[model samples]
Target: MVSKTDDKKAAPAAAAATAKPEEKKKVVSTIEEDDEFEDFPSADKEVIGWDAVEAAEKELNAWKDSWEDDDNETDFAVLLAAEKKKVSSAMKM
Candidate 1:
C-alpha cells in the first residue's frame, strides 16, 4: 500500500535500521614493556676457540656476500647513528 516516494524514503530507514554498528579497533600501547628476559648468563657461556672464530667470520662473510645492492642497502654508520639516537631518547624517557 506504500507509494513509490514513501517506499524510497522507507528504504533508507530500513537499511539504516538493519545496518550493523562498527566494531571498535584494538589499541596497542607502545609504552608497555616486553616480558622477555634482559640479562642472560654471559659469564657461564662457553669460550670460542680460534677455529670457531674463523668459522664464524667465514659464515658472516658468506652471508654478507649474499646480499645484492637492490636490497635497499643502508650504511652501517647511518644505522649505528640511528640506534644511538634511539638509545639516547629512551634514556631521556
Candidate 2:
C-alpha cells in the first residue's frame, strides 16, 4: 500500500525505530593512595653464586640448541609457528 513518496517518509522512521540510543558509560577513577597500593616482595639483593650462574648459562644454552634444532628441522620457521598454533588450539579442545 506504500507509494514511493510514502516509502521514502517511512524509511527514516523505520531506521529511527531500529536504531540504538547512544550509551553513556561512567569512567572508573584510577586514582590510587599510597596505603591502597600492594607491596611487592623485595627481590634478593645478594649476588648469585657461581653455581647458580653456571646453571642459568646451561639452561640458556639448552634453549639456544633447541631453537637451532627447530630451525634445521624445517625450511621455514613460519610453517613451524603455524603448526605450533594448530597444535595449541587442538590441545585446548
Candidate 3:
C-alpha cells in the first residue's frame, strides 16, 4: 500500500536510525585516538601537582649547578645518575 515516495522516505529514516550508533562509535573512536597518550596517569598514584614539578626542577638545577661548578665530579656524576634513574622509573609508570 506504500507509494514509491513514502517507501523512499521510510528507507532513509531506517538508514538514519541505524547510522546513529555508527556515528556514536565513530565519535568514540575519535576521542580514543585523541587520548591515546592520556593513558599514562595511574589511578593509584597521586597526581603530580605544581609542588612536585617545582621540586623536580630544583633537583635538576642542583644537578646543573654541580656540573657547572665542577667542584666535585663525583657529586655531579652521582646526581646525574640519580636523575637518570628517576626519569627511567617514572617512564615505567
Candidate 4:
C-alpha cells in the first residue's frame, strides 16, 4: 500500500531502530612490574665453553654436507628454518 518514497524513508527508520548503540569501555589502569631473580643473573653470566663451540661447529658441518647432497630438493637452510617455526609454534601451544 505504501509508495516507493514511503518505503525508502521507512527503511532508514527501521534500520535506526534496530541499530545497537556502541558500549563505552572504561579505561583500566594496571601496574606491570618485572621481578629480578637469582637465576636471571646466572643465566646472563653463563659462559660458553670452546669445546662446546667446536662440537657445535662439527655437527653444523655434518648437517651442511647432508643438505648440500640434496641439490635437487628444497634448500636445506630453508627446511631448517621451517622446522624451527614448527617447533616454536608447538611450544606456544
- Candidate 2 global CA lDDT score: 0.47
Candidate 3 per-residue lDDT over residues 16-43, each given as its tens digit: 5486766546656776655444332232
Candidate 1 lDDT over 11-90, as tens digits, reads 55555435522211111233333443434323223343366555456443434555545542378857877889999999
The candidate with the higher TM-score, 1 or 2, is 1
TM-score: model 2 vs. ground truth:
0.21
| lDDT top scorer | 3
Residue 67 CA displacement from its true place in model 1, Å: 22
Off by over 4 Å in 3: 1-73
lDDT of 4 by residue, 26-50 (tens): 1122222222221222221234346
Evaluate residue 61 in candidate 3 and report its C-alpha lDDT on the 0 to 100 scale.
43
For residue 3, give model 4's deviation from the true position in Å. Answer: 99
Residue 78 local lDDT, model 1: 72
**Residue 60 deviation, candidate 2, in Å?**
34
**Clashing residue pairs, backbone N/CA/C < 3 A, model 4:** none
**TM-score, every prediction:** 0.21, 0.21, 0.22, 0.21
Off by more than 4 A, model 2 = 1-75
Pairwise TM-score winner, candidates 2 and 4: 4
